[model samples]
Target: MTDKLLNHRAEGSTTAPPLLLGPSLGTSTVLWDTVAPELSATHRVVRWDLPGHGGSAADLIGPGATVGDLAVLVLALADALGIERFAYAGVSLGGAVGLHLAVHHPERVSALAAICSSAHFGGSQPWEKRAALVRREGLAGLAESANSRWFTPGFTVPELVADHRDADPGAYAACCDALAAFDLRDRLPDITVPTLLVAGREDPATPPAHLREIADAVPGSALVEIPGASHLAPAQCPQAVLIALRAHFSGGAKHGMEVRRQVLGDVHVDRAQARQTPFTARFQDFISRYAWGEIWTDPTLTRRERSMITLTALVAHGHYDELAMHVRAARRNGLTPEEIGAVLLQTAVYCGVPAANSAFATAQRVLAEEAEGTGG
Candidate 1:
């Protein structure tokens, strides 16, 4: 543990789980401005400036630096803030720092999201050239092209361009040197924490294929490609990045179980878990993470609305066995008996009377059981 080496801003309650947001090279903490504030509602977010960018001291790293050096600095900042462990998300070079942490310091990271980043950054020859260019002529030329490199055509963030232009030439060049040396392709399999890779569909820097490669190698890791986004996705399309981050860091199996119990009741979920076997373990996980965790937990639709949609879908598909179970779930989601009937009745026209008739019988039986359970 060391004193903070990076300039950073912390938000959210001290009791909340900490989440560190990292920035791309030549950009400052401003790169995270659009997303961090909202993320702080649930996470104690600490977005830091890279060496020589924003408020961090330009002397933090010199020429020939490595991403490991940056990782250590990030750890120092975490220690200074009294954060023993945290979830991590970053863009580009910042994302690379997160991958490094997950590989070398797994205990420190709870989860990870790498956006518009890569496993090796295309072998580093280009980075070496960029380093030489920055050291010789400064960042003016690069800053002028920042918009083209960091975003899609006609989309730009003036502050980020200025950050690039204003970054210390020596330090920026040193970061480029670090990029030249970074290559984590071999270590990708060693990452055990839940990982997520978000790619910009139009990004010329780290394209979707780069993130896909990571997804295929890191066990259980997921990938999300944002259409119409470029290199700096958080700035260009913060909502998509936020959704991905929230889902990735949403506690996975544990949170899924919580939502599962809430929707289906404790008895059902407990019985399901108690019956889980080695052969059925993966299926159980898929239900929890995919159905309960991802779909059921999405806030876009209220649980009541979801119940209605679910009941209708179940009837339409003739899943009467499952429909009986969800009829109870619909009640738990606050749908009255009549409301559930209405949904099933709507299915009569669309799903045919045969399917709706069976659905009605199942719903009636489940409702009777519920009535008996509570003296209704």
Candidate 2:
């Protein structure tokens, strides 16, 4: 059943981890144009069109087709692409599909970001009405109102409107039917993948509260709200959406290496790597894989926040040698000299003046040396 119900476009290097992107029911891969390219720089991004939308065929969708059926089509697409395990991010209906994958095929999904979507799309009556209207009047029946729901006022993208207008009425109606029967609220806790829920502040369709419900249900899931955007937040607020997605998807060893070098400086990282001996090789690998790759690369907190936290902890624990190295890293992560001083001052009261005093002296020496190196 998966021969061609979905139309897929793959980008990025073959060696990179596969990241599957799903578009909203009425939209196509164009929905991810702004976000996918940037993510492709680190991940192999594969964006696909929903059946009957964009270049995909509507023949697979029949009367009373369920979201599960749509989810199966996505799995088939992944199978066809030879993707065994991958990360997923989807918008609206696309997000619902990702949720389905995480719940049903947990082994296949590494992480998920469900943007402007909900576990259950309210009651079925509204969806039934939409399905009937589109089925009776064709795609033209819902084009204007649908497009309006997609974006905030004065932020329309003509390409998105065109994509909505060009959708096949039958397929769109089938998707509406899929949405009507979709109810994953009770199953939310079953989703074990590291998940992120994103909402647009102004989205009336699936409001922030809708996404919040899912976020509350899914354990260990995080929620992010985008300001000044509507249901199609990815298109309306690409940068914010991209930042959230990158943080979720960029936790691999390769990306961790890049981020580690960026924060710690290439020279310092290279020196540490060069110092790795057979006896210390395993410890180096562990820190690189766990600390830098997994924890440090997380996007939920900025590098600056991590830097400040790392410096404070070092001073509190009297880890002066590591503290000195991190002082240099903190500077690279945008912590000003004044900010570093303030951290030490605050630590002085809680961790003892002696500890803070030594930290200050070490920080001063590192800062002065850096100043001389940079001709400051």
Candidate 3:
């Protein structure tokens, strides 16, 4: 693998799963600075600069390099880092690299988030003209225009513009050539990894419509449009982009199962599975698919928040049995006994004293049983 990639481990832990990041052509890994730190809390972030940008050498991109060729370099980088499988997020040309990897090397990708990118970057003539212009006059000829395309008004990052200016023109031209020949529309259906496509509503470079085409073609892929962003949505609107990436990477059926087990405990989940008869199998699947898969797996709220909400709702509805179950879940989600009591007490004001009283009784019994079992 080319030693061009930069790796940053999350500050608190080294055990998090790896996440590879790619930048748009002419930009360096610095393009991801806004979101990478937040993502690093849950992932070991590995970001790479395009050839000729940042630390990567211009000579590394040989003549006529294709997007597939860049995909190979990414896989090589992963292999070098001993990452057998990883989540990936990229922007523009970087997103194109992600598509190539997801399509051709499916086993290596755990999940994918493509921002302001397309399966096909439209007709080749524009790319050809850009490549020719860069080759003749260098990136200086196109830097201002390219920077303008990347962000909506008042959202530009000076560093990102500098990245474009610093890039080797020959390498940038080669990337343009790559974009010219890249087309993977037919291969979208073959991707099985959970995928997210983010588009900027104002992006003149790769508009929301471009991402919509890929989303429709890729089975189960989700598309999101950031309202006022342009090409560099991740940089311009980091919070929105981070939310989408976090959900895509960490919210899914498998993740839902993990969250379910964590909330309900392994014993409860195993017992529920064991009690499933053919007649009840569909019910179990429904809970797993909808309740856990759809609701519990939402990344917008933490498990603790959901637990508190669930407990309150159950008490308000006078669902004592469910309230009892969720009382145990609330404890598992790190809710303290005092906090549980507070939720029950609050229910009295909104849901009536009788409902809170019954909920209190049920929760007290469950909490006692839990305390006794653990000798706490």
Candidate 4:
């Protein structure tokens, strides 16, 4: 069930749903080598090299190639491979392409996973300058910038350095140009695909804020930040990334929606009823089946354990309201006072004392309510 299509090839389980994976800037399908084996164990993976970047072909669409154009090439590759509907995952530029496809051609993309990417890459003069350099002097001129953003100084290796050096200048420049003109900020609301955004905590280029913007812009998209990792999170933390991605696709919308509703409750439905917006009905449907049914239904962990982890995460992140509500739910999940205190103490060191203090205060208030209710 695996063969070369127009620009890509399929791998892994033939019976399982196919995953169309796109490469990052200046990388080839080979970039997925370290991670593909892990993903392919259960699902069919389709990895592709953008034109002029890898073994597929050396055709440069030039600096004028738009994100939309890259998306079209992806769709065509899927069509040529006879893949009607499949999950999509990409890194960096590849991630943006997945978003574009999910937005523009929803039916073709069953689910999405975007790593270290943004909805809008912005229009900065530095980007234009880099593109100009790549086009004129080739990828060599842009090597330092790419290296700085892609790898930590201490982790650089001979092979890794050579990989960047070996990249096709034309393809690198073309992708840089595409990114320069890419902007989907205003249109992010239209995306309905189940999406996951993964970013490195130490990533200087895309950063966690870029992932945060994506999560906020796309309703229901979950964001995961891996600590101690750089921009190459997929490579640095493949196991975590694959675990989340598989859970999303295999479980789909039904499970996640159910879990979300049980935890977040009818915040959506109540708001919908209050406003009666046209999207209200769909909103209710989405929460019930996807958030609650799929994600919550999984036996992976008890609702209580999940709640504790989620609350700890939000507290660590300084999302006060969300942290507060989850703190309340933690009691229902049977989280003990000591456990909550432990989470706070852990966050104090990693997430700052001020944030941990707020979380501890919120937890104390919720614990008092539990105590009073039991006493009454």
Candidate 5:
């Protein structure tokens, strides 16, 4: 493992899960900036500049410096941060690293998310050829290729294209090599952690079929396609990506998005409330479309199960206001008192008695209010 790499961290509530994130090739933690706010609201999102990207050292070593090497580096980073176990999420090259960790060190990951990545990354000719160009000419040689793979047709920005072109060739080549060697086709069945495979409908690089293969291969893995988004789901459609990821990670996505919306409410409203600003008129769009449209529409899991997971997350993270609201929503969704009790009881062990106790009390209040209103 390289002894030096620049890791970027944004502090969210200390209560949420510690998510160790890995970035894509040639990009730093900046790739997560757009999506971090929504995620950080409920998770301690950790992103690092991989070996040759951002402020990290650009040392392209021998055979061992592969995606597996990056996975090892991330594990070491988690250890350094005192995170014994965490939920893992990554994109492209980063997703490949997450796969390695999930297969080799399952205990270290609580849940896993793979975005725009494949177990057997398609023909390595593209990446191999790019790596050679980087080695021979420099970062300038692989500019056009990176742009085509990274951005979709309509969304490609000239400045962003220029920036990628200007990135260090050595680092770019190193990442390409890692991508070229990544292959977990047979190992996906061994990953026990609950997994989420996200794809951009327009992602030409990995394509939807690649994500489908990952979902089918990984037991209990769920697949979600981000419409209109490219390989850079977080960057292209942050709201959609954020809702999908958070719903999956927090376990509220099972009952569909209506359950997620009821738990988190509208992101815009939640954001305004958190910041003590008045809710804007347009905030309703955030609730109707994102919180309800996408997530609530999926009907794979029961509302009761979704309630349990969402409540557990809220209690664990100490999101009291949302917890109270969800408690009411659970009741509206026909959750019984015993079920609510069970959720809180479970949280007592996973989160803590105090947080669970608070949730229970709020549940009682919400249930009582709901009963009285329904009776009226």
Candidate 6:
């Protein structure tokens, strides 16, 4: 039954690329509450809660559990969702699970982002001690110090702290066991998938050096360090985490999204995004990656020049609706009304009079709308 799977929340269009999100040891899926919604605009985001932490059953894990064990559960979750392959990003313990998946189950992972995670976790002594303490004393005392260990001064997530407080003691201790024996340093060089390592500079637990170590060991990996952030960077610096995730997961699409906003304007881009459906997700990605990222971003031509070329092409092809949209883009690109008219007139000589006349009618309506601030 689905109840046997890890507790997870899925968002975005089903046809969109799948992206699995993992939470830190003590956190629930709510750790991604702020960032996952926006990422769902392009990805089918599925964020899961760790065993004994959120909605998952405590018995899902035990004292001798390893990160690999957690990873297996993740694969089971993906299997239950009918996801054969997916991209992954995780924080802390979650990040370790992502790395395990990438290394041990490369065929299942398309890309990876390990945030505030490490290859060795500074050996197992400290985690062993912590686990022992949790086992003997329960989570009340440990949860009290969670904010200090997980966040920078003056910043905290009460929900996450409560999660720590409410977590099943045995499962939480078992997770500590997982962290205790975890060591991927030797396997770092084996990760061939695209990898991104993020570090919170102020994090005393798993600092920037830990992430840097993974970056150095992993071939062709990238690293980003966020200041003013601690172990839970996504919770404290969600926008920063979001930017890094977007860049890492969809390089061209990320840059293309920015260009799309600039060329088409926010209102227009937002409208297009709003109208995007499961059937249209792939097309939207193509427009962003190929149209905006590659072509429009080419340095060989300026925005103004590109706008002029686009107008001519639309007119030549008799794409009146697109011509109308580009007419507004031309204005935004710094083309004066007279300059646009001149371009349209030139199109008539090559594209024939009928097409140009129709283009003119469309452009006139767009120009009139722009004048009244009624449309783009």
Q: Could you say which candidate leads in TM-score?
A: 6
Write one digit per residue (lDDT tens) for candidate 1, span 1-376.
2244899999888988899999999899899888999888778999999988999888899888999999999999999889999999989999999999999999999999999998888877999999998889999999999999999999999999999999999989889988999999999999999999999999999999999999999999999999999999999999889878876886656678889999888888888889999899768866886688768887999999999999998888899988988998989899999999899899999989999999999989889988889512
Per-residue accuracy of model 4 over 307-364 as CA lDDT, tens digit each: 7778778977789876767776665577777887887898888889998989888878
Better of 4 and 5 by lDDT: 5
Local distance difference test, each candidate: 0.90, 0.88, 0.84, 0.74, 0.75, 0.92
Evaluated at residue 15, the lDDT of candidate 2 is 84
Residue pairs clashing, model 3: none
Cα lDDT of model 2 by residue, 1-376, tens digit: 3456488899999888999999987788888989889888878999989888889998878779888898899888888888899999999899999999999999999999999999889889999998999888987656777766888777877887888999988889999999999999999999999999999999988999999999999999999999998999888899989878876777555666777898888888899889989898657755765688868977899988999999989999999988988998998889999999998998999999999999999999999989889511
Off by over 4 Å in 1: 1-4, 252-376
TM-score of 6: 0.74
Pairs of residues at least 3 apart in sequence or in different chains that clash in candidate 1: none
TM-score of each model, in listed order: 0.72, 0.70, 0.70, 0.64, 0.68, 0.74
Best by lDDT: 6
- Looking at model 5, which ten-residue stretch has the lowest summed lDDT? 252-261
Residue-level lDDT for 125 in candidate 3: 92
* Residue 376, model 4, lDDT: 12
Model 3 alpha-carbon miss at residue 99, Å: 0.6
Q: Give the per-residue lDDT of model 6 (tens digit) for 88-205.
A: 9999999999999999999999999999988878788988998999999999998999999999888999999999999999999999999999998889999999999999999998
* Best-to-worst ranking by lDDT: 6, 1, 2, 3, 5, 4
Q: For candidate 3, lDDT tens digit of each residue in 200-315? A: 99999999999999999998989999998899887889988987887677554456677779888888889888999989965775576458976887689998899889988998
True-structure lDDT of candidate 2 = 0.88
Candidate 5 lDDT tens digits, 170-220? 767777887887778989899999899999999987899999998988878
